[model samples]
Target: MNGEDELEELDEESLHDSEALPAERPNPLIIAASVTARGGVLWLPVAGLLALSGKKKAAGRALTAAAVAMPIGHLVSLVVHRPRPQAANIPARQALPEHPDSSSFPSKHAVTAAAFGTATALEDRKAAILVTPLVLLVAYSRLRTRVHWPTDVLGGLVIGALVALAQAGIGRSARARATACRLFAMVRPVLSDHSCPSSVSE
Candidate 1:
C-alpha cells in the first residue's frame, strides 16, 4: 500500500481501538463523597463522635436534624414527582450502582448533610468548619453523580437549613424555660417562709 493508504489504515485502527476502550471510571474522590453522603454514613458518625466527646446536646441536635430532614425530604419527594437525570433522558454519569426507585425532587443526602452540618455548626462553630467541606462534597456529589437536579439540591439545602433553625430555636426556648423554672424554685422557698411567719403572727 502507498504511504497515504497505510496512514489512513492506521488512523482507522486507532479510532476503532479508542471506541472499544471501556468508559472512563469516575474520580475516586467523587465516589468517596457520594458514599460518604449516604444517609447514615457521615452524620451518624459525627453524632456518635459528639456524644462520645460529652457534647450530648450537640449530638442530640444532629440526630434530631437527620431524623427530621429525612422524613421531610421523602414527604416532599412524594408530593413532587421529578425524574432523575438518566430517567429524564439527560446525559449523566451515574457513579453509584443503586438507582433509587423514588422521585428525585429533593436529594435526601443533601437534606441530611445540610441539616446535620447546620445543627452541628449552631452548637459548635469549630466543628462545623471542619465538616463544612464534607457537607459541600455531599451536595456536589449528588450533582456530579447526576442523581439529583440542581434545583432539587438547592431546595434540599433550604429545607435543611430551616429545620436546623427551628431545632435551634426549640433548644433555646427549652433552656430558657428550664432556667426560669430553676430561678422560680430558688425564690419560692424564701417567699413561702416570709408569708408563713406573717400569717402565724396574725
Candidate 2:
C-alpha cells in the first residue's frame, strides 16, 4: 500500500514480463549460412573449381565482379550509415558469430554472392543453376539471422546483378580480352608454376 511496497510489486511484474519473452535459438543451417557469408569464403572454392575445370576466363570474370562489388557495397554502406537489424532494435532470430564492424545498408555477403552467381551464369547456365540457389540462400540467411533488412539484400542484389551484367558485357569486348592478356602476362610467373592450359592465353 505504501510507495516502496508498490515499487516492489511493479518490479516483480516487470521481471515476470521479461521472463515471459522467448529466447532466440540457434539453427545449424543458419549458422552455416552466416559463416559462408563471411569473407567470401564460400565463393573462393566456387571460383577455384571453375579455374580447375579449365573455365579460367569465366572464373576470372566472376571473381572480378565479386571483387568490384565488395568495395562498392562497402562505400555505399558507409554513406548510408544504416544500422543493422539488431542495431536498429529490429529483432533477429539469431546473431552473427562475430559481429561486423561495418554499417549494414547493403549486405556485402549478398552483393558478392549475387555478383559471383550472375557472372558465373553468364558464362555457364548449368553452373548458374547451382550458384543461384546458393546466392539466394545467402541472401535469405542474412534476413534469417537478422543481420540485414529486406531492402539491404535487395539493394545488394541489384548492385551485384548490375556489376555482373557490366562484367559480362565487357568480357565480350576486345579491350577486355586485351586487358585480360595483360593481366595474365603480369601473373605469368605465378601461372608458370601451375599447368595453365595454353588455350587460356589465346
Candidate 3:
C-alpha cells in the first residue's frame, strides 16, 4: 500500500492519531537508537522529583488528574484490546519489549506527562515550557518502541487536555471563592445602604 493509504487505515489507529515515522526509513536498529535519545528519559525523573518534592496539594491535584485520565484511557484500551500494531501487520519500528506488554490504545505515559505539565503550569510558566516538548517526546518514544500506533499517542493528548481542564476547574472554584469575597467587599456598603427599608428614609 502507498504511504498515504497506510496512514488512513486503523489498519493504522485512525481513532487516536497517526504515529508513523518517515516512510523512507525502515531500520529497526536506527529506530531503537533514536527513540529514547531525546528529552523523553530526562523528563520522567525530573517530573517525578517535582512530584515528590513535598508540594502536597499541587501534587495531589496532579496525581488525581493523572489517575482519572489514565484509567479512562486504559478503559478505552481494555475494551478495544486493540492488538499492538506490531502484531497487526504494521512494520514495528523496533522490537517490542518483553515486560508490560498489553493493550496500547491510549498511552499512559502521554497522559501522565500531560498531567505533570498541567500541574506545573499552575505554578510556573517556564516549567510548563519545559514540560510541553517532553510530553510530545514521550509520546514519540512509544511509537519508536514499536508497541503503539500514532493514534494512541493522539488519543492520549486529547485525554490529557481533559485531565488538565478538570484539574484547572477545581482550582477555578477555589479562586472564585476568594475573588467573590473581594468583589463583594467593594460593593457591600452600597448594598447595605440600599437594602435599608424604605420607612427608614423618614
Candidate 4:
C-alpha cells in the first residue's frame, strides 16, 4: 500500500480500538474502594477508641506505629518521585476523585492501612484478622484506581509492616518505655477526658 493509504488504514484501526474500550465511569466497587481509602482517617481514631476502651498498651503501640510509618511513606514518595500507573502508560480508569500531590511509588493509603493493621496485630492477633482484610482492600483500591502500580502498593505494605514491627520491638526496650512514660505523662493532662493512660501496659 502507498504511504498515505497505510496511514489511513492505521487510523481506522486506532479508532476501532478506542471505540471498543469501555468508557470510564464510576462504579460501586470504585466508590467502595475510595471509602476504604479513607483508611488514613479511620484507623487513627480506632487507636484512640482502643485507648478509651482501656486497651492502652494496644492503643499506644498502634498509635506509635502509625505515626512512624506515615512519615516514612511520605518521605519515600518524595525521594522516589515515581509516576502514577496512568502516567506510566498503564491502562487504568484513573478513578480516584482527587489525586494526591506526591509520587505514586509507595501508596500512602496502602501504607497507612498496612501500618495500622500490622500494629494492631502485634497487640492482638484476632483483631488483626479483621483489620488485615480492610488493609488489603485499600491496597487493591490504589491499584484499581490507577493511582499506584502493584509494586508501589507492595512497597508501601512492606514499609508499613517493617515500621510497625520496629515500633513493637522498641516498645519492649526499657529505655524506650521510660521515654514513652514521660511522653504519655506530658500529654495526659491535655486530654479533655483526663482518662488517657500514662504508660503503655498490657
Q: lDDT score, residue 176, model 1? A: 72
Give the TM-score ranking, best first: 1, 2, 4, 3
lDDT per residue (tens digit) for residues 13-122 in model 3: 43232445533334555454334423234444555666676554554555566666666776777876766664433344324333346687777666666766676677
Flag clash pairs in model 1. none
lDDT per residue as tens, model 1, 1-202? 9976874464334212133321234467876887776764777777788788778777788779878988899999999998765532322344576668699778888888889889988998877877678788888777665666667787888888889999999878777766666666667676754332332222
- Deviation in Å, model 3, residue 95 alpha carbon: 4.8
Look at candidate 2 and give me any clashing residue pairs. Answer: none
C-alpha RMSD of candidate 2: 13.8
Q: Please give the lDDT score at residue 75 for candidate 4.
A: 90
Please give the ranking of all candidate structures by lDDT, highest first, separated by commas: 2, 1, 4, 3
Which of the two candidates, 3 or 4, achieves a greater TM-score against the reference?
4
Please, what is the whole-model Cα lDDT of each candidate in the order they appear?
Answer: 0.73, 0.73, 0.59, 0.68
Look at candidate 1 and tell me the lDDT of residue 60. 83
The collision pairs in model 3 are 9-12, 16-151, 17-151, 19-150
For lDDT, candidate 2 versus 3, the one ahead is 2
Poorest stretch of ten by lDDT in candidate 2: 14-23
How many backbone clashes can be found in candidate 1?
0
**Each model's TM-score?**
0.76, 0.69, 0.60, 0.65
Preferred candidate (TM-score higher): 1 or 4: 1
Q: Model 1: how far is 72 from its true place, Å?
A: 1.0
Best candidate, lDDT-wise?
2
